[model samples]
Target chain A: MNILRFITAGSVDDGKSTLIGRLLYDSKSILADQLEQLEKSSAKKNDNGEIDLALLTDGLRAEREQGITIDVAYRYFSTPARKFIIADAPGHVQYTRNMITGASNAELIIILIDARQGVVEQTRRHSIIASLLKIPHVVVAINKMDLVDFSQDVFNNIIIDYSKVATQLGLNDVKFFPISALQGDNIVDRSEHMAWYDGPSLLQFLEEVPVENDTNLKDQRFQVQYVIRPQTDDLHDYRGYAGKVQSGIFKKGDRITVLPAGISTTVTAIEIGGKEVKEAFAPQSVVFQLKDDVDISRGDAFVNAAEAPELKSELDVILCWLDDKPLQTGNKYYLQHNARTIRTIVRTLEHKIDVNTLQPLEITSPVTLNEIVKAKLKTAAPVVYDSYDLLPANGSAILVDETSNSTVAAVLFR
Target chain B: MSAYQLNYLEELEAESIFIMREVAAQFEKPALLFSGGKDSITLVHLARKAFAPAKIPFPLVHIDTGHNFPEALEFRDQMAKEVGATLIVRSVEDTIRVRKLTEPKGKFASRNWLQTYTLLDTIEEFSFDACIGGARRDEEKARAKERIFSVRDEFGQWNPKLQRPELWNIFNGRIHKGENVRVFPISNWTELDVWNYIREEKVGLPSIYFSHERELIEHDGQLIAASDFIRLDPEDVVIKEKVRYRTVGDMTCTAAVRSGANSIDEVINEIKATRISERGETRIDDKVTEAAMEDRKKNGYF
Candidate 1:
């Protein structure tokens, strides 16, 4: 079965967690013991004699006490068609970092917009994040339709408003779903009340959505993670570069070039689980044996010589400041790209993009927490990278606070 | 034409292998924590595939609780030898003796929590910067919030609230001198994913995982294997049942479920039909409190 990794983002009380819990509960993913525990907890909290499904994803003690999700909580559930990994991201403005973290690896994002209040600021904020993270699919789940008496007008208005935000953010594959998470409408099964609405249920869309072609199959990029050499007598001469193919396809006897070193060699062999294969593609972890013994180690990239990625010491990037401390110009950080980590200095803070307004503000002050900004960075050594629009896996990097070693920023190269 | 897409299992394997390789490349001294369970066995397999032809760069560290299943201990040793890995065994009994710590008593007593001390001591002894384990987020509620590369304080405590934001596929494994990282390569995998991978990879596991006729004792509605270490209360009755272990831990606390899954295929089918979770059915340590796993993890338990 395939795995469809997605995330849910919405403000507090917007039913993001409730939607996730409903999906899990309706799909029979919640175990008997877990459901029992949820019931007992609901009774203790006296949730109006109704089981509060939101309590399922609120795993932390503080989150339970505060009745708010504080961090990203990954929930796993599977149907016969596919396994789903849901990153239930906290929706508060203070937890924007959490949402970005959740959406980083997500292929789809469910931006919950309360039907009573269509397309609020938080909804736009989440849409910008989904676009910034390059999430391939976007589903605007207009939740709490029951509160509005399951009105089709409310749902249509939400779709109309969210469509503008989606277009502005350049989110191409945006789908709108109208549902009430509390009443389980248009989630697992089609809602009879909404006969006017013609579309697949949320679960049906999630199951049938094509996630296979999401990867970039036009550019072959592989980062050598480890150099394998067994000095044992039987395999004394064996040498291979182990890594997952980031994009495109690599076949046996294909000519590839090692980045930074710029040396070309033929792919003598491709081995998956120690068995030689004719070819390998994106996301497949394999070892590549080169015909010529070119000097390559961890942090080296294997690319098609015909289409090498841009190599430079200076890069213009859009980064989300994740650290508590504000980003200062001329401060050095440890920039980690793929398997490579190098000292990088913040050259300039160009402008900060106000996610709420979708406008870039001139940098009059330091970039603070959860602020998205376009900046220039100079690394001590040249690094290989692609535009994030071209290939997200190879185009992104992280900024590590040199002193505390915390991941301070998420870098997306332009 | 068939679309070139990796199935869920293959994607999980590739992600795990990437994490293992990251640990090797980022850390100074790394070790794989082997528990002889299906998860750890799968971790070992992924580690081997991550760096084929070459032996695993690091050693395998096993925190011996001295209450392990005999079959599990034997399998651990044999697998270590087969992989040509240096196996380092640290005994919880030694930690208990040296620290003058009293073991828990009565029907719910288990050495699972005490294993934390031995594990921390082993890391300090070897100066291992990264300790990779097979912890999956779907195991328990507390584990759901863990990052792929979790940082621990010098004292080996996990502060869930203060965890670093892990973004994209890039994991920040940098830490101060005394601090270490606990890496979970399979953090995204579920129990079913592990079983499917085990079947696909043909990974060897201990005999206890498969169904067998074993002497069992019923305690607090849980079917536990009757072992020499567990003291039976008068109310508990010992009987023979065909059972299989869902999770392998200290035999004193790990519960067994009645099953006829004698083969991997049967086990997969059995798990597919299982309503109770892997930890909910077994793992007596997590049954103590709602935050039992969190409390133990805060004190450096794997």
Candidate 2:
């Protein structure tokens, strides 16, 4: 089976946790013991006197105390066709850091909308995030359909309003469904309440979505993470570059380039899991034996010599400032990309994004917690990367504070 | 979908392999914290694949609690030698003797807590910047909230609230001089996923995982083995039953289930049919409190 990693764009009030709980509960993923525990710990029960479904996603004591999710908690459930990893994050405006952190690797985003309040600020903000992260799939689940008498007009109006936000942000594959998470309507099975709807249920759409083809197969990029040299007599002279196929395929005899050094080498052999394979594609961890000995260390990129990405010292980036301390211009940070770390200085704070309007406002002050800004960074040396818009797998990095060593920002190269 | 796409297990393997290689590339001195359990065995397997033909780049560090099942130790020794990887064993008994630490006393008192002291000391002695373990998110609730690259303070304490925001799969593993990062490559995998991967890969496990005739004591509906480390009670119901371990920790704290699953397929089926969570069904140490794992994690227990 395949895997679909998605983020639900709502909080407890929006019934995000209830939707997740309904999915897991309806699919029989929640075990008997877990259900018993839920029954024991539920603080809020519905009129039916059943366990609160929202308790399923709350993990920490602090979160339970505050009755809110503070961090991204990954929940796993699977049907026979697919495995789903739900990055359940808080939807309030203050918790944008958590939402973005959860949204970074997600292939899909479920932007929840209450039917009564058609398009709230959160809907636009989440759509902006989906566009910024380039999440492949966008879902608009118009919840509380039962409270609205399962009206088609309410569902269609929300869809019409969400489409404008989706178009403004350039979010693709916008699929909408009318669901009542509290009553389990149109989540796993088609709802009898809404007879006018004819689309597949949320579970059906998830299982049938083409998530397997998300990898970028055109751009060939590899980074030498570890150089394996056995010192024993038999394997004395063997040197291999161990790394994942970040993008594209590497055959046994393909020509490759060693970046930052501009050295060229031939692939002598390819090995995966100790067995010599003819070729390895994207997402496969393999050891590449080069034809000649190269002075390559960790963080050195391996790409096709035919299509080399320009190595530049300056980068135009959008920073999601996640720390309490403000991002001071002219301060240095360690730009970490994969296993490689490079010194970088904040050159300029271009602008701050107003997520509500999907517009940019001129920055007058240093960026602080949960704020997104357009900025320029100058690296000590040239680094190799693609634009975040082109291929995300090979084009992302993080900013690590020099003194505190905390990850202060996520820098997406534009 | 293209043929290049990998299945769920293969995808998980690729992610773990990438993380293993990342640790090898980033840290000056790294070690694989091996406990000879199925999770660690799966980790060792992934590490081997991450750097094939070449031996695992780092040493396999084992913090022995002096309360281990002999079968696990034997299997550990054999597997380390088979893969030509170096094994470093440090015992909790030695740490207690040298550091003058007190051992808590009870009927089934565990050295599981004391093992952390030895682990921290070993890490300091070696100046290891990273320690990779096979901790999964599905095992416990506290673990679910932890980052894949968990940074521990100078004293090896974990701060759940102070964790760095891990964005995408690009982990931020940078730490200061005294701090070290605990990397869990298989953080996304579940208990059933591990069993399925083991079955597909045909990875060898310790003999205790399979059903065998052993002397056991039934306490509070849990079947525990009668080990030398455990101070059994006079009223303890000791019986000889065919039991197999679901998880492997110290012999005193790790419980077994009465089963006839002598094969891997049967074991997988039994796991699929069992309703209780993995840790809840086997680990006695977690039953002391609802936040037992959380408290231990705060104090540097893996």
Candidate 3:
């Protein structure tokens, strides 16, 4: 079965965790023993006779004590149709960095909107982040439908308001669902209360949504991770470059070029687990043997010579500051792109994104924690990359602090 | 451009291989924590594929509780040889004798917790900057919150709240001297996924995973494996049943399930029909408390 990795984002009390809990509970994914424990804990917490489904995703003791999700918590469940991995991110603006981290690898995103309030500020901020991250599919779940008497008018009004934001952000694939996560309506099964609505349930939409076509197959990009050389007597003089195929298809006799070094070679062989394969595609970890010996090392990349990526020493990037230390001009960091890590300096701060209004604010100060900004960066050495709009896996990078080595920013090249 | 994407198992394998390569490139001294379990065995297989045509870059470290199944020990030795990797074994028996730590006694006595001390000692002795293990998020609630590259303090304690934010495929494996990162490459895999991978890859495992007639004793509604370490009480009834282990841990604490699965295919089918979780049916350590896994992980138990 295919795996659908998604994220749930919403403001506090919008029931992000409750929605996930409902999905797990309604699908029979929650085991009997786990349900029993949940009941006991719910009774102890005394949530006014209501089982707090939020407690299920709040795994850390600190999160449980604070009654808020502080970090990204991953939850797994599977139906007969597909496997689901949910990255439940905190909704508070201060934890926007956590949301970015969760949404980075997500193929789809479920943005929850409380029915009473339509298209609030948090909703717009999250939508902008989703568009910025290039999430392929978006599901705006209008939660707490029971509170609004399951009114189709309320759901429709919210959709009308949300559509404008989606249009402004250039989100092409947006779906809407009205559901009561607490009362089990239109989440797993259809809701009888909403006779006016005619659409697949949330689970149904997730099961049918296509994800495989998102991979970039026209451009072949493979970053060499490690050099494999078995220096034993029997297998002497054997050298191979091992890595995951980031994009496109590679065949045994395909002509490939080693990046950064600019050496051309032919793929002599492609092996997966000591067995030779005729061809491989994106996301398959394989080792390639070249016909001609080349000086390739870790961080070097290989691509189809006809469709090579842009190679440059400077870049314009959108960065989300993740560390507590503010990002300032002239501050140096280790820019890690694929397997390569190079020394980088912030040459200029173009502007900080006002997430609330979706406007570019002139930067008068350094970028602080949880702030997103577009900046120009200069690297010490030339690097090979594509626009993130073209290829996400190869175009994206991270800025690590030189001294602490902590990832301080998420970089998207333009 | 043809539409091609990896299946679930292939995607998992690719991600794991990527993680293994990151550990190899980022850390100074790394080791694969081999426990002779199915998960760790799969990890070794991935590591082999990660750097094929070359010997595994890291050594295999085993914290022997000295109560291991004979088959597991033999399998561990043979696997180390096949990979041509260095094998380092640290014994809990020696640590107990030297440190004067008292072992739990009576019917439920187990050396499982004692292995932590030897493991921590081995890390310090070898100055290993990173230790890769086969821990999946689906196993326990605490594991669900763990980072792929989990950072441990000098004392080997996990601070869940202080974990660094892991984004995309980029993992932060930086730490000071004496501190280490515990890497879990298969964090996204479920129990069924592991079994399916094993079946597809034809990975070798200990014979005990297959059904065989063994002497067992019933304790607290569980079929406890009859072994020298287990001190059966008067009420405990011994029986000869065809059983297979869903997970292999300390023999004293690992329970067995009645099954006729003698091959990998049968095991996969049985697991598909099984209702209980792998740990729920086998591991006794996690049943101690609601947050037992979390507490143990905080104290540096892998």
Extract clashing residue pairs from model 2.
none
> What digit string (tens of lDDT, one per residue) describes model 1 on residues B157-272?
99998999998889899999999999999999999899988898889999999999999998777988888788887877889999999999998889999998999999999888
Each candidate's clash count: 0, 0, 0
Better of 1 and 2 by DockQ: 1
In candidate 3, position A297 carries an lDDT of 92
Against the true structure, whose lDDT is highest?
1
The sequence of per-residue lDDT tens digits that candidate 3 reaches over residues A2-70 is 789999999999999999999988877677667777787788788587787877887766677788888
Docking class of 2: medium
Among these predictions, the greatest DockQ belongs to 1
- lDDT per residue as tens, model 1, A320-403: 999899997898999999888889999988889998976989988889999999999999999999999889989999999999
lDDT of each residue in B263-282, candidate 3, tens digit only: 99899888877667778788
Q: Can you give the lDDT of residue A31 in candidate 2?
A: 80
Identify the candidate with maximal TM-score.
Answer: 1
